[model samples]
Target: MASPRALPTPISATSFFQSKPTAHSLNSSSVSKNLSFWRNGSGLLQLITLGSTRSRSNAVENSSPTQFSSESSQISDVPILSCSEATEKLRTTRETYESKQQYLAMYSSIFGGITTDPAAMVIPMDDHMVHRGHGVFDTAAIMDGYLYELDQHLDRFLGSAAMAKIKLPFDRETMRRILIQTVSASKCRKGSLRYWLSAGPGDFQLSPSGCHKASLYAIVIQDLSPSDNKGIKVITSSVQIKPPQFAVMKSVNYLPNALSKMEAEENDSYAAIWLDEDGYIAEGPNMNVAFVTKEKELLMPRFDKILSGCTAKRVLVLAEGLVKEGKLRGTRVGDLTVEEGKKADEMMLIGSGVLVRPVVQWDDQIIGDGKEGPVTQSLLNLILEDMKSGPATVRVPVPY
Candidate 1:
C-alpha cells in the first residue's frame, strides 16, 4: 500500500499508452477496482490523466497510496520526464503554434547574453517579476532601422523602477547601449522593442528583500502589419481604475486594463475608457484619451491620475503646429467630464501601440459626425512623418 516513487527514466508516449507492468505493479484486485472506477466515470478520469506523468511533485510525494481511490490512480499515471524530455516537449509545443508577431531577439541579464531562438527566450519562474509583479516595463517603436523616442521611453522606464523600489542592474547609459545592441542584432527595420526591470529571482514571498539582484530583460518584436487609419468605437469601462500612485508607474500589473479591454470587445467596441474616482475621464485601458472641443482646442485628461503616455506628450507638441496654422485654437490638459468628452467634436486614443487612432463613437454618442475627423487624420499623418524623418533627438539610429 506504499505510494510509488517517481520514474527515473523518461518514457515515450507510445510506450506510455501500451499496457505494461509499471514499477509498482497493481494486484488483480486493485486493477479490478480501477476498471470499475473507469466504467463509472471514464471520460472525466481519462481527461484528468491525459497529460499526467509520475513527476516529482510535492503533492505526489506526500500522498498515501493506501488512502487513494481509483480516481487517484488515474491521476498518478503521469510520467516523470527528464530535463531533456521536458526541453524537447517545450520545443515541440512551440513549433505547433503560430503567432502574428515574431520574436527576433532577446537579452536577459540573468543569463548575461542574447538569444534569437523563441524557444530559448524564457525567464526564471522564481523571478519576482514573474510571480509577484514586482516589475516595470516600457516600449519604443522601431522604424526604418531607427528607434523612435528610445531615450524618452527609457527615462520613463527608470522612473517606474524607482517608484517600484527596484534597484537598477546597470546605469541608464549601459542599459540604453544594450537595448540598441539588441535591436541591431535583430535586423528588424520596422517593429517594436519592449524591456523590463524586475526585482529578480527569489523565494516565492510577498516581499522582494530576498531577491538576489535586480534584473534587466529586453526583446525585439518584428511587426509587419500595415497601419489602419479607420475610426473605431469605444465604451466607458465599468472596471475600477488603479489608484493614482500605482497608475502613474508602468508596472506589469494590468488585470483591470485587460478586463476593461475585454468588456469593450463584448460591447462590440475597440477599447474601454476609464473614469477616475471623481467621475472625470481618465484614460483608455492602455492608451491616453484626447478630445477636440467645438472651439478647435485640443484637450486631454491630466496625467496626475493616469499614465503619462509618451505618444500623447509628442502629440501635444505636434498639436502646437495646428494652433500656429489656426487649425486649432489651443491645447490643454485637465480634468474632462464624460459629458464634455462626449460632446467634443473629435476624440482619439494615443499610445505607442495605437499612434493617434480616432474614435468615431463613444458609447451611444457619435463623435463629431461619427466619422474620422480631418484634424485626427492630419495628426496621424504628422506622427507617421515624424517617425520616418523626425529630429535627431526623437530618433535614435541603430547601427544594423
Candidate 2:
C-alpha cells in the first residue's frame, strides 16, 4: 500500500489549540529525501530525503504545496483550518468578574502607588522578579478582625528581602501602615494578608542592576472557614532542604519545598519532613515540628538551617505557662534525630495555616500514645486565647 505523500503534518497542542492559524507551508524537497515515513495510514508513502532536520524545519515554513510532486505522494484535498476557520474550532470562552467581592482584593504599586483596581492587579511581565525570580514574600493570618503577629512576620519579610538584596519600596513604618490599610480596604475581618517585595519591572536581564527600584504588593485573601486542627500523617522527605543561607530567607524559590510536599502527598501523607545532612530532623516544608518528651520536656529543632517559624516560637513562649504549672519540665531547642522525634510522648506541627496539629503517626510507626495528647490540646487552647485576647504586642488591630 502506498503511503499518502504530503499528508498534513500533525500539529502539537501549542499550534493546534491556538485560536487561529496564521500561515501554512509544506516541505517538498525534504519530503522527497531518503527517509520513508507513513503519516498513520493515509495511503501516503514518502521518504524524507538527505536534507538536514533544520533544513526540513525551515523548508516546511517556506515552501508551498505546489512544490511537492504528485508522482510520489498525493496531497489531501481535505481543507486545513485557515485563520478564519480555526477561529471557529479552537477558541475558548473566558469568564468575567466585575469586582472581587469578599474573596480577594489586590494592591499594586509600579511607580510606588497602591490601587485596588481589578483591571490593574498585575505586575509587569519584564520585572526582574517575574523574569529571574528575584523576589521575597511573607504572609500574615487575619482572625476576628485582628492581624496576628503582623509585625513579627513583617520583620521576617524585611529580613528576607535584605538577604535577597531586594530594596524596600517604602520605609518599615510605611510598609506596616500599607498592610493594615490594605486589609481595611478589603474589609475582611477574618482572612490572611500576603505581601511581596520584588525587584521591579525591567528588561529580561539576569541582574537587578538595570532595574530602577523594587516593588511591594499586598493582597487580602478571605478564608472565612475556621482552622482545621485534624491530625495528619507525614513521611520522611527525601528532597534535600535548601542550604542555610537560602533556607533562612523566605524567597520565591520553592521548587524543592513544593516537591517535598508533593512527595508526602504521593505517599498518602499530609506533608513530608526533611532531614538535615547529619541525619537529624530539620523541619517540614512550611511548618515546624516539636515533640513532648517522655520526661515532659518540649524539644524543638534549632533554627540553624530552617526558616524560623513565628507561630512555633510563640507556642514555645505560651508553653512556658505549662512549665510553671508543672505540665512540662521545660522547653529547649537543639538538633533532633528521627528516632528521638518518633519516640516522644506527643508531636505537633505548628504554623500560620495550622495553628497546631497533633501528629498521630510518622512513616509506619505510631507517635506517643497514638492519640492527640493532653499537652498538645492545652497549648492549642492557649494559642487560640492569645489570638483572641492576647496583649496588644502580639495582635495588631485591623481598622475595619
Candidate 3:
C-alpha cells in the first residue's frame, strides 16, 4: 500500500493570512489591514474556522490554492458572517460614511413601528418593491412644523397605488397619522415626508402572487439647503416617453425618466423634455413644463398624458391671481407644440421639488431674452409664501 499522505499542519487565522505566498496573495495587504482594524480590543471573537481544527487545515489549504483556480478563487478570504455580524457591519459602514441627504426618521409596516436610526431604516431584501419595481410613492414638504399639501399628496399616493393594483396596508386616516407621527418622532421642522405603498415582502419573482400582503413605508428627510430659483437650461430628450397608460400614474417605473435626465446632464442641460407620441410637448423628467405665450397667457400641456402635478395645479390656481392683477392675460392647459413653446415669452418647470423653476433656454434657442422671467419669479414667490403661511386646506400641523 502507498504511504499515508502527510496531513497539512493546522494554522490559526492570523498565521494562515501571513503565510500566504506573495504571488497568489492578490488581496493579502487589504485582508491584513482589515484583520488588524477589526482585531482591536473590542472583545469580539476572531474569524471562526470551519470543522475541527485538524480537519480545517485541509480547508485552509484548499482555500489558498497554489494559484487562483478561477477568477472567483481570488476572493477566497471573504468572511461568512452571521446575521448579527452583518447588522453590526451595516451599522459601522453607515457610521463611517457621509451622506448628502440626512434621513431623520422612517416608518415601516414590516416592523409596525418607526425608527430614528438610519441603519435600521432598511427594507426587506425580498420585498416586491425592493426587487421588482412594484410600488407607488408620493411626497409632501414639511414647513414650520406643518406638512404642506398632506391631503393632496396623500390622495395622489392612494390613487397611484390603486392604479398599480397594490392594496392599502391601512386606511388613509391611519396612514396620515403614522406619517405625522414619524415626522414628530424625527423632530424635523423643515424637511420633506416621502412615503410608498407596495406589494410587500415576498420571494423574488415577476408577479406579486407570492406576496404576503401590502406594505407602507414612510421617511422624513432633513433638507437644510436653501432654495435656488435661478434659471436653468433643458434639451429635447432622445429617450422615448412612456405610454400614456403608465405615464399618468406615479409608479416606481422611472427608468425612462432617469435615462432622459442623464441624457440632459450629458449634454450640459438641467433636464430633458419629452414629447408625447403625437409629438406635442409632454413634460420634464420629474416636473411639468409650462410656458408664457407672447400674449402673456400661461400655457401647459394637458395632464391626460402625463403625471398630474400637484404644484403645477396649485400654480394654475395661483396664476389666476396674476391674471386678476394683469400680470398674465390668462391660464390654459392643453397640448402645446415645440415651436409654440420655444417661441413663447417665457418657460418654467413646475413640481414640488423645483417649485417654479425658470427655463432660460431650450436646446439652442434662448427663452425670452435668456433670463428668468417676471412671471416665474412671481410664481416662485407665491409658492414660498403659501408654504410658509398657507391656508389650513393646504398645510397640516404636526402635533409633536
Candidate 4:
C-alpha cells in the first residue's frame, strides 16, 4: 500500500462547529430553481454526459432575452455597478427569461454568443466533445461578491488543457479577469461559475491536429439551497477509477465518473464513491472524500489517485489548527480501505460547489448511526465560518 501523507494533529468536534457563521439572507427558492437549471441544463453536466437530449429540444424556438441591452461596452471600459444595481439587473433578467426556451437562448447569448436555436445546442449528432471528448474545464464558487480560489482553479484548468494538448488562447490572468467580468455582468453574487475551454468545432477524427483553436465560455449560476446542505446518502459502486497517466487532469473525458454517479442514483444514492483497483477508496464523482476516525483523526486519500480539491485543502488547513490545539489526533491522506471508511466515526465529501456535505450512509451500512455525525457537523461549521470571514488578503475589485 502507498504510504499516507505526513499526518497533522487532529481537531476537536466542539471548536469545529462553534466557529461557523449563521446563514446569509439569500432567497432559498430562487437559489434552488437556479441551481436546478444550471446543473441540469447548462454545460456543467452536459460536459460530463457529452450531450443533453432533453434540454436541446426546449432550447429551440426560444428568443434570447433582452438582458443587458445588447450594449457593446467592454468590461474594462465600463464602470462597476453597485451591489444593489447588479442585483436588480439580475432579477429583471430572470423575470424576463422565466420560460425554459427563453432561458436556453439567453444562456447562449450571454455566455457563448452563439445564436443557434436551443434544439441545435444538444443535437449530439456532431462529433465536437460528445463524440471524442476533447475539452477541459474548471468551476469555482462566487461567494460574498468574490470568486473564491479562482487562481488555483485556473492553474488546474491550465494543467488539464496541457494534458489534452488543447491550445487555450487566453492567458491565466486574462481568463481570470474575464471570469470576474462575466460574473459581474450576470450580477450573481452568491453562485457558481463554470469556465469551459473546448477544442474548437472538429470532425469525427480522434486527432487533435484537425481541431481549430479552442473556444472559451462561462456561465454564472445560483448557489445551492440550504435543503441540499442537510446532508446526503451515498452508495459505494463496484465501478473503480483506473489510474491513468492523466488521472490528475479534469478533462472533458468523464465517462467513468458519469457512469459511477448513474449507478449510485440507480441505487437511490445522491452520489457515488468509487474504489481503485486495489479496493482502496478513490473519491466521489466530483468531490474529494474525508473521514474522521474515533480517535478524531482526519483521513483522506492521497493526491496521487484523486484531483487535489481546493476545498479539501482548506479543510486540511483547518484541521491542522485543531491539531495544534491538541483537540484531535491528526490528519491523514492515503490509501483508505473500504472497511476502514465504513468503520470511521464520521465521513464527508468536499467540493467547490457543495463545500462540505456529511455522508450519512455508505452503501447499505450506516456511517455513525446514519445521521450527521458530530465531528462531520463540526468541521462543516468551521468551513462555513471561514468562508463568511473574508480572506486576509485584500480583494482586487472586479472590473465591470
Best by lDDT: 1
lDDT string, candidate 2, 1-400, tens digits? 1111333553322332243222241344323335565555544454535346786667546645445433123323324443334433433211233333344567666635555443345577778878798999999988789999999999999999999999888899999998898888887887789999999876778988888889888888776565577677999998999999988899988889999999999999998998887888998999999999999999999998899999999999999999999999999999989999999999998888788899989999899878898889998999889988998888999886
**Residues 277-320 of candidate 4: C-alpha lDDT, one tens digit per residue:** 77888889889999988788999988877788878988888887
Ranking by lDDT: 1, 3, 2, 4
Error of 2 at 226 (Å): 5.5
Cα TM-score per model? 0.84, 0.78, 0.83, 0.68
> In model 4, what are the clashing residue pairs, if there are any?
8-330, 9-330, 10-328, 10-329, 10-330, 59-118, 60-118, 60-119
Q: For residues 1-400, write the lDDT of model 3, one tens digit per residue.
A: 1111221331224455444443335333343322322423423234432334545444445664543344233444566454455667889998897876799999989888999888778887778988899999999999899999999999999999999999888999999999999999999998899999999987788999999999999999987677788899999999999999899999888899999999999999999999999999999999999999999999999999999999999999999999999999999999899999999999999998899999999999999999999999999999999999989999999998
Query: Which residue runs of candidate 3 sit more than 4 Å off their true CA positions?
Result: 1-65, 69-75
Q: Tell me the spans in candidate 4 whose CA falls farther than 4 Å from its real position.
A: 1-127, 223-226, 392-400
Model 2 RMSD in angstroms: 11.1
Highest TM-score model number: 1
State, as a TM-score between 0 and 1, how close model 1 is to the true structure.
0.84
Candidate 3 residue-wise lDDT at 64: 42
Better of 3 and 4 by lDDT: 3
Worst 10 residues of 4 by lDDT: 1-10
* Clash pairs (backbone) in predicted model 1: 52-78, 53-78, 53-79, 54-78, 54-79
As for lDDT, the candidate ahead, 1 or 3, is: 1
